[model samples]
Target chain A: MTRTSAIFRRELSGYFTTPLAYVFIVIFLVLAGVLAFFVGNFFDRGQADLQSFFVFHPWLYLVLIPALSMRLWAEERKSGTIELFLTLPIRLSEAVIGKFLAAWCFAGIALLLTFPFWITVNVLGDPDNGMILAGYLASWLMAGAVLAIGAAVSAGTKNQVIAFVVTAALVFVLAVAGTPTVLGLLQGWAPSSVIRAVAGASLFGHFTAITRGVVDLRDLVYFLSIMVAFLAANAIIIDLKKAD
Target chain B: MLEIRNLVKKFGPLTAVDDVSFSVPEGEVLGFLGPNGAGKSTTMKMITGFLAPTSGTAVICGHDIEAEPLAAKRRIGYLPEGAPAYPDMTAAEFLDFIAHIRGFHGIEARRRIAYIAELIHVGDVLHQPIETLSKGYRRRVGVAQALLHDPAVLILDEPTDGLDPNQKYEMRGIIRDLSPHKAIVISTHLLEEVEAVCSRAIIIAHGRVLADGTPAELAARSRYHNAVRLDLASDEAAGIAAELQKLPGVASVEAAADSGQATLWVFPQGGQPISDAIVRLARTQGWPVTGLYVERGHLDDVFRTITAPDATGNALRDAA
Candidate 1:
């Protein structure tokens, strides 16, 4: 546990020491705001909640999460510091969890910085603060799931660009898996069970369910299972590919 | 207290390290010598638990590297090839991180970092990021990181590779100072380094151990061991060469190309000292010998002879 904290501290501080973290946070905030008010038609809908703001989170994280995770393992491998890291007394799982948590915390910090949107809805009229809080929690969880997938993909190669591109493509597929466009296409030929399963597996579906002010146990389980499954995959991939 | 037993590492059809085995007791500095791509780094990686050996194990302080890697790794301070470190980190921060991972914390970590920085003479560059430092400073920081925890075993791969002569001397001094309590293994291609700091030496080639002995013992394997070389003013090279060969216990005499002065090298049949006999012969023949010396043998010659492509037969012949 001490070793994990040491790695976590080092990795967390690593983000703040560079301009990348500030740039990523600013871009995430500006893009989320613009997408919610302009593209999301928040005032036009006359909504008293932050549904518009929370709705853009999956898209916002698609670009930003990959940027955060591309360096987790790829940069370590590229700089040859992975040699020093792995030879330390820490276990493979500890290093994996430590790094993943650091990235997750950074994402959470960026998500929390968008609180003004929630405040705006509260000031305009009586809004469901409970739903807004659930939206924030679900947003953070979904971001963790995306970042976990990014972490696993990052371990497969030493090129940050490749990690980023591959992760973005993968998250895009997961985000669109349950949408009408994808389900409609699958409904034409696939079995009903296959389409339902695909719809159930969609990140967009679980995220939307939580944003509706109803946090189901199954929805929570979906996000948690994604994080756990991908994080475990990340550890396995790192162990198998570390020596290469 | 390190034992490496028949460690073999094969990557596909290429065997990077093959049946290489050696041990280092406390207070001994073992110099690992080999030509490039001869598996020196590969062996070190396997022993450090950075890479899994295809079929063998290394025991460090009673822990098997393959079975109990974390325990084994805790007792070892390894400097991998190229002295890899986080480029963006300052030397102080980097060392602190290493100290923490090695189980030091708070004031204890700070004290150890200070001690190691001063010991390795990296105090001046402690605040500079490793990427901004010169190659020598970066190398020193890498060394300091390895020594931060003061493990019982030190496995350094080319520690003095990029250092200048003075820094190399200081590094050797540090290794020597710490050698009494720790088992040290340093891999280097620098032949003189083995003689300078190593208490024992192992020469590997083609992923196999070719020779293991003290510096003097390995140097004695040279064909020129105990040979005599004479620089005389006389120019009758062929006549003198024949006479030198006829001397008792003399193996062969090779004369240098005819210059204004004559130079002849006389090998002994059994590495016997024939300098006095040659001096007497020079006096009787009225030949003025300008210079005379007995060879202690050259390590460069021995290294080349032992690692050459046809070295197996030549090595056996030389041994005979």
Candidate 2:
């Protein structure tokens, strides 16, 4: 709807109007490159694929997505623009979805800026471009899921730093829940259904599953469901807290 | 064009807006008056659909705020307290966004943005970031955004809060210009503002309506209504007060010496016209009267007399 686009345009431009967009993009590119080439040992593997570039996306997103989405709602509340925004002739869902789409689009832009990684692999050897493209798709999906979590947490507080820290902590727990160490701790006593539920909620688990060339419907469903569920909660949280 | 019916808002155990209700027809400018924490802003929020009421609802142009918030909101323009706006956005950008959400786009949006900018005197600062603009300009931008669509109902909370005298006067001029076609509700701590623009005034405290009437009607409730103030050059404060008290319609007289001159305030019985009788007495007695005038009462006194000092009175009412 036109109303939603209006909010989307304002929120997206809000990033560029300040140093937030440039600084965030700069940090995102530098960190993603360092993690992929230096820490991730992209050349050391030399398997004619971007396995190194794709492996660190979960860790990359855990920190970067929160930063991108922190000010989406928190700054609005702090600056008192949220009241003006909500009182406009639009539904609460429109504002929520519009702001989320802006933050997600910014994340997509930052992810797209990493195309040199893809280009480097293609020119260096006969890499499976199909697998690399799949990796990018998986990363974008996981980033959307992460940004959704950040948006929900951002709605509950007016402090952007608090939103960032709390979102980081919450997503960190979700990403680590399906690790062998955590599952080992839950085994022998916890029910298998509970363990499966915990594993299904692990963002890194679903993220890693989709990076191996073929996109799975279950993985797509998982990411989309997280987006829908978290965004719905974001709307409700903003409604309860907008009056604050 | 606007009506509120028994609107109540309670925050946990404390009630922020009690059973308060009022309506404003087209062409009427209602001045909402109350001290700090008097539920004026809370009521405005409910009417604007920013906060949901615990009990009642507001109807804007026949659209119930709770039943069809989008419809009601479309018909209302609200300038909240402090005139909050996006700090990072330029004034032009902010208004353009508002115009877009108000359903105008492209050339129509640009045309409206220009017109509202001119009407609000924010033309020069249209490209400046709102945060960088002066307080007066920022407040005008707030008013400009609210006036973008020219809704039937306008709710402005302290529209001229931080402006200078000239800006405040201009702001009042704008309100006077717009009131002929719209219903307006303005909340202020300035009694002079009420006298200048408001057709009717409502005083509230502890989330309850204390008094509602025309500005003159509320002022006439003051005890000083129809009273006379006399400034005499002579220093006989006591003797003249006694003589003035003996006038046929005079209820009581009190005189005080200021800078070696005596000033007397003569109250009339039942607010009768005692000025003629006092003049006759002063002339017959050949008193050294330098200045004399009858008082039409004052809004400040009426407001003070009607509102209690604390929440105890409201709490008592709540208990019953």
Candidate 3:
């Protein structure tokens, strides 16, 4: 556990040690705000709730989270620091979790910086703060899942750009799995059970369910399971690819 | 103590490290010598648990590397090839991170960082990011990181690779001072390093152990062992060469072209001392011997002889 925290502390401070952290946060904040106010019609929606704000999160994270997680393992391998890191007296799982948590926490910090949108909705009218809180939690959880997938993909290659592109493509499919466009295409030829299963597995579906004010146990489990599954794969990928 | 037994590592169809094995007792410095791509780095990586071997095992402080990697790794302080470290971190922060990971914290960790920084002379660059530091400083920082934990076993791969002469001397002094308490395995292609610091030497070639013994012992295996060279002012170059070759116990003699003097090298038949006999002969012939010295043999000659592809038949077994 101490070793895990040691790695965690290094990775967390690693973000702030460079301008990459500030640049990523600024881009995330600007894009999320712009997409919500200008494109999602947050002010024009007039709904006192942050549905318009939360609606753009999956799309925002589709690009931002990969950028955030691209260096989790890829940079280490590229720089040859993975040799030093793995030779330490720490388990592979601890290092993987520590780095994943650091990236996830960085994403969480970016999400928290969107507090102004929450304040904007609250000051304008009576809004159900419970649903807003749920929206934030769901968004952070979804970001964790995306970052986990990105971390796994990052371990697959030493090139961060490749990690980013592969993760973005994978996350995009997960994000649109439950949308009408995808379901419609599958409806004509696929079985109903297959369609239902695909929708249930979508990140968008689980996140949207929480934003609707009632957090289902299944949705919470789904997000946690995704994080765990991908993080585990991240550890395995690092072990297998470490020699390369 | 560290024991590597029959360690083998194969990367697909290529064997990077063949069944190489050796043991380092406490307070011994074993110099791992080999040519480029000769598996010195690969062997160290497997022992340090950075790479899994295709077969065999390394035991550190009685802990198996593969079965109990954490325990084995805890006993080792490894400086990987190229001395890689997090470039974004400052020297102080990097050492602090290493100390923390090694289970040191607070005042103890701070003291350790300070001690190692001073020991390796990296105090000047403590606050500078590793990337901005010079190559020598970066290498020192890597050394400090490895020594911060002060593990029982020290595996340094080319510790003085990028350092200047002064820094290399200091690094060697530090390693010499620390050798009495730790089992150190330093890998280098530098033959002089083996003589300067290592108490024992292992010569590897083609992913196999070509020879292992003390520096003097390996040097003794050269054909030039106990040979003598003489430079005389006399103009009888061929006559002296013929006389030296005819002398008993003298295997062969070669004379250099005359440049106002004759230079001759007399090789011994069985590692015998021929310098005294040559001195007697020079006195009897009234030839003025301007220069004379017996050769202890050269490690470079032995290294080339054993590592050369066609010289496999002449590879000497370990003298130990």
DockQ for each model: 0.79, 0.86, 0.88
TM score of chain A per candidate: 0.97, 0.98, 0.97
Higher TM-score: candidate 2 or 3?
A: 2
Interface RMSD after interface superposition, each candidate: 0.9, 0.8, 0.7
Clash number for every model? 0, 0, 0
lDDT of 1 by residue, B201-257 (tens): 998988989889988888888878999888888777778888888889899998875
DockQ of 1: 0.79
**Residue-by-residue lDDT tens digits, candidate 3, B286-315:** 777789988998998988888777744343
Q: Please state the error at residue B116 of candidate 3 in Å.
A: 1.5
TM-score (chain B) for candidate 3 is 0.96
Q: Where is the poorest 10-residue window by lDDT in model 2 chain A?
A: A235-244
lDDT of 2 by residue, A134-224 (tens): 8989999999999999999999999999999999999999999999999999999999999999988898888888898888999999999
| Stretches of model 3 off by over 4 angstroms after superposition | B256-262, B311-320
Q: Is the docking of candidate 2 incorrect, acceptable, medium or high quality?
A: high
Candidate 2 segments exceeding 4 Å error: B310-320
lDDT of 3 by residue, A114-184 (tens): 89988888899999999999999999999999999999999999999999999999999998899999999
Residue A50: error of model 3 in Å? 1.4
TM-score of chain B of each: 0.95, 0.96, 0.96
Deviation from native of the Cα of residue B227 in model 2, angstroms: 1.5
RMSD of each: 2.0, 2.2, 1.7
